[model samples]
Target: MSACNAIASPVLDPKGPIAAAQTQLLLDAVAIMMIVIVPVFIMAALFTWRYRGTNRNARYAPNLAYYWPVEILIWGVPAGIIFWLGLHLWSATHRLDPYKPIDPEVPPLRVEAVAQDWKWLFIYPEQDIAVVNELVFPAGRPLALRITSDTVMNSFMIPGLGGQIYAMAGMQTRLHLLADEPGEFWGRNVQYSGRGFADQQFRAIATTTEGEFGAWVEKVKASTQMLDATTYEQLAKPSVKVPVTYYSGVQPGLFDSIIAKWHGDGNHLHAQVTGTEQAR
Candidate 1:
């Protein structure tokens, strides 16, 4: 997509609540920085013309040194801007924390993500189904992702939904996102792993229509393919630009086993954190 176009930037054209807030923050940052940038550029032009050697009428103050007003304008203004920006950043960091649930009252849809060499595996535990390079969830609900890498480290991001989290072998990362309505948002691995990294992408579908999510799940369940240990072994092999695949069944505890395979202790820390969140 042409990011330079007004509507081409996924970040700027947010379809989710978190992305919308991030967009606002970006615009605000630009406006605040322009407070100094615009005037500085304009003053630079005026100063260059006024102090030119050809301009004899211009006042030449060779010995005139410091002006407290100008010093305050440059130093104090930036200081204030930095202080304000810092506060905003601090608040946002906590407010948009990926671990925190969007609405504590609403139960989040859990999706386990496994990052491989050149593709993504999304497993819906509650639904007992899995898909390759496609993530589907009900819209207007919070999505809680448990992500890890089976190969090299990778970064997961959905620009239109905001936030970026890394997936590392033997470690699980958390990210919570919510879509405001039905739409297909782009999801990809931003980290560079190999030649196939360019094709490490997926489609995130948010279903707004009633029964849509259920119908999609049913469709996946109707697929003949099954995800067993042997099946997963072959599926994990490195490949590029893999077409979407659906599995009617998933081996129980498959997600945990993948973590244990890499990290001897398993995702004990993440499990503990998840337990604590549930209690609250």
Candidate 2:
């Protein structure tokens, strides 16, 4: 498919360097495997046609037990492919580690992501604003996401930006991504939690310039709505296809609080909050 039609398969339609690298790696792996697969299928068809019962003149070597050249060809080719694949996979795993920050020269924008029931909550701690079922960030800037779930396990993914990571109640996962250019992409929960799983999707907007992102934040901040413990409790309840909503004032350390609440003991919860309170 053309890049213009990338919205249909976000994984194939990468908008950032990290995602573009991943897409290339995927294509390389498929191409390498097809090298062996295509030949094997073609040889199978040729052998079937040449040795068919109707072809009485076909050579038959029933006693062929140990042919060094044939044995080498059969085993060496697969081993070579496997070795090449292993090397690429190892390199990609380390280079694309989700925890590894991107573009150290450019400080990453921190965003706290919480997966609740059938919706997504994105809190911009630095900006002191929050939005539900919508995320906005500036293009050409690195994004560092700290993700967790308040309910059952879920996967936070933006196929056009980078890979997917799991989010569990009480456990926070990190993901780093960036947008090479301005565009809108799709984000969704890949893991099935309940009846509303299919509707658990959001829009990721990447603005062209820092000024545009700042303006968007200001617009959200102008909203009179507030997101606090009480409001969060209501939002946490199971819901489907929720409309995009913005909150002007967000409670401090709200993301950490949600993760802490899942811990069994009060002391652990307190410790978790204390350790993360100063974190942006």
Candidate 3:
């Protein structure tokens, strides 16, 4: 369902160096673009006032000559802007590449994510754990996510953290994010995936310590539902505004099996179970 929480806002917080750099880049670009845009408007206003019909002394030269320096000033400025933009673009791309590892002293926490019909499935492979509707990570630590999709393409995004990465069947995309503070952030599917697109959302809880994360994982593992193949089939079906759920134990490599089937590749043949749940 739509996860709109008013408690914490990630965009307003600059927890790490990358986030701060990104914010500065945005501000600088806006300032640079406005240089030409503002002056053009002022010149247009001045020309309109000075060239009014009543002023007979105003030169009405219909044949205007083109000045090379003025042409260069107009064209070269934009070209320089484009070059500046390209440099920043390349720097950010290399820095944010999902596969690229973070600093050795502060490596990103690994997270495997799967985007399904109308929900998200997050698995912490190191912990041998899974959560159906919620995801958690430690603050001030880099997060490396291995993301993929089930039926259609979806995007994994947390604006407070960083850019959105696509989750498509048969392929894996990487995303790196970090939060400096302990708070709950919002994550959602930015792209339409199907019937319940609008309701596809989840909670991204950023905790302070490993102990707290371990405790939360233990609580999730203590849930009553068994997340076997059958249970997953029901849970994966299209459902709108479904409440958050946790499964005690999940079948190993269930996400891989789904990806295999979706790609039509003969990786592993898992039985497909159909359900009558209404598509949202």
Candidate 4:
């Protein structure tokens, strides 16, 4: 999408009220900071001109110690600004903590996510399906995602949404998001993992209806190879800028296995190979 169009989309159709509120709050904070920053910059320039030694009219007070009131203006003002900022930030962060549930009336759809070397794997336990390198969901439905990483730490982020959540090995994190409209959005592995760090990104396709979403699942399942235990072992290997792929059937609870292995389980010997496969 054009940059102008992308900018307009988020405003015109925010994922939900919470996201819209966040965007507004961000813009407001920027404006407030600018009020102080702009004046400080202007004064800096003015001081350079007004205090020029070449101008004999300029008074130079060599014995000048800071006046108490002037010191108060310098410290108190910034402290107050910081206090205000801290209050707003603290409240907003807790209110929008990714793990917190939304209103009871609007239940969220749950999806489990895993970040591995060079790719993302999303599992819809409710739908009994999975996808790699692509995310699809019904637009307007609240989505609550439980995320983790198979090996290294990664971050789940989509700019048009809100704050990102970190996915670390053997640990689960949560993120709640929704696309207000039907279209494609991009999500990335914001943190560097290995060779593919620069291009470890994927598309999120939001559908208008549940039927459309089901059709998508069927299509993906029909078009891909069956991902069994062996294939998954190959997939988990590290690599760079790997292209996207869809798997019709992945080994049962593969993500769980990865998490277990990372946590020091001995069930899978494959997981024991550490740095050797870092390049895959």
Candidate 5:
């Protein structure tokens, strides 16, 4: 499972600002921990060799239970490490908050994400378009995602872009991410929901050229399929390994309506979406 997790998440190869920052924090933590680990390993090897039968002169401290120096070395050092690590984590947690806007100076592209039983749905509210199993945005631009699950709980992640954020039924989550360059990244569901969970994957395309994303959006908009409440009900049915599907148009407030289904209070999300849309 550990090896499978490593293979599934390509977090080491960070392609975006958030992922890069997270990778650096991981490296820093490991480096700090090695300060104690390396010394403990060296001392263990030395003690083993010195106490061997071949070395009869080795000192015996069988009656020894407490030594202040050793006590300080063990407890004090670890306590200090804990203190340092806590400070580091406290600072990083806020800076790398998933909900925090990556670049406030630049208006972010808003994308609504819905995790279904066996596939992912990405709705571009501003563009009035939606796609399944594919997410597209411009490179070097901030992307703000509003996520919720239409089925069971799922974790939405693009490992090279940022950390995973949970998408739960009835509740919305926010994740802000940015890609530094044009490339294709894999996005997947980290939580196991059912048999189709393994095939719940998507492609996240980052376009770099000016207007390249617009052109791609235009291409998607040309698709004949339209996603309305009826179409969505049919699409919501469980299916495995669905291909990349695009809907040129979507029913207005469809994403909000899905969230409203669980709460039975349709106006709350509607009002929130309206305020944010107006603010943006």
Candidate 6:
């Protein structure tokens, strides 16, 4: 395969600030580890050559048992590296949390994502718009995503966006992200679902300006298609490699309804959706 075809992962080509930060962290960790790794490898080669049986004049101490300095060099160095690694992990975990909001200066765009049988359904509740296998938003604006699954377990991931979160039936998960510049990024289900899992992919377009994003929404709204209960039921069915689709209108509270279905009782679902559920 050609080099272009072989390089398909977006994690290596980050386009967002969060992804860039993550990439830096990975590089830093590897570089720090090599400090000890490289020296150990070099010492191994040197010791083997210096202590070779062919070297008749080599000095040897058969009674040598322990050396405090050597012991400290072996154990202390690795312990210190592990300590630094722990500190970095703790800081990164909180700083890059998926639930935390991005830049406060830019108003966040709310998006509800549903992982269906073999496709992605993105719903814009504020705009009353829904699309299948396509996600579009304005660049430089924070994106707050509420994700869930209608059928089975799945994961929602955009490699250029940094983190991947699970979307489970009956439970809602949150992810916050933003695109530093305007461009199209790849999104897919990293977790295996079923037969159509390989074909499950989507394009996430980040428009350059708010006006362009507004125009795109207007164009979608002009479509005649509607996503009511009946249409949604059909969309929830098993399918493979579905094309991008647009819906001018979406049913109200549709996302909540999908989460409620797995709760069994209506009250529990309501409480869970409304964030009022308490420990039993």
Candidate 2 yields a Cα-based lDDT of: 0.89
Error of 3 at 19 (Å): 3.8
Name every residue pair that clashes in candidate 5.
Answer: none
> Per-residue lDDT for 1-280 in model 4, tens only?
2354345445424565566767877887887788689989999999999998787798878999878998987888888878888999899889887787765578777778889888888877666566778788888888888899987889998666666789999888888887777877667888878877866777777899989988988887785586555676777788655566777665556566667776675546354333224533
lDDT of each: 0.86, 0.89, 0.75, 0.75, 0.89, 0.86
Error of 2 at 160 (Å): 0.8
Q: Which TM-score value belongs to model 1?
A: 0.90
The C-alpha stretches of model 1 lying farther than 4 A from their native spots are: 1-9, 265-280
TM values, all candidates = 0.90, 0.91, 0.87, 0.83, 0.91, 0.88
Residue-by-residue lDDT tens digits, candidate 3, 141-219: 7888889987689998876777677999878888777777888877789998777888788888998898898888899
* Model 4 clashing residue pairs (backbone): 238-280, 239-280
Which residue runs does candidate 2 get wrong by more than 4 Å?
Answer: 1-9, 265-280
lDDT of 2 by residue, 1-280 (tens): 1244336437887889888999999999999999899999999999999999899999899998999998998999999999999999999999999999998898999999999889999999999999999999999999999999999999998899988999999999999999988988888999999999988988899999999999999999999998876687789889998999999978777898888788766455445544654454
Report the error of model 5 at residue 63, Å: 1.1
Give the higher-lDDT candidate: 4 or 5: 5
CA RMSD of each candidate after superposition: 5.5, 3.8, 5.3, 5.7, 4.6, 5.1
Better structure of 5 and 6 per TM-score: 5
Clashes of 3: 3
* lDDT (Cα, tens digit) per residue for candidate 5, span 136-198: 999998999999999999999999999999999898999999999998888899999999998
For every model shown, the clashing-pair count is 0, 0, 3, 2, 0, 0
lDDT of 4 at 47: 90
Q: Global CA lDDT of candidate 5, please?
A: 0.89
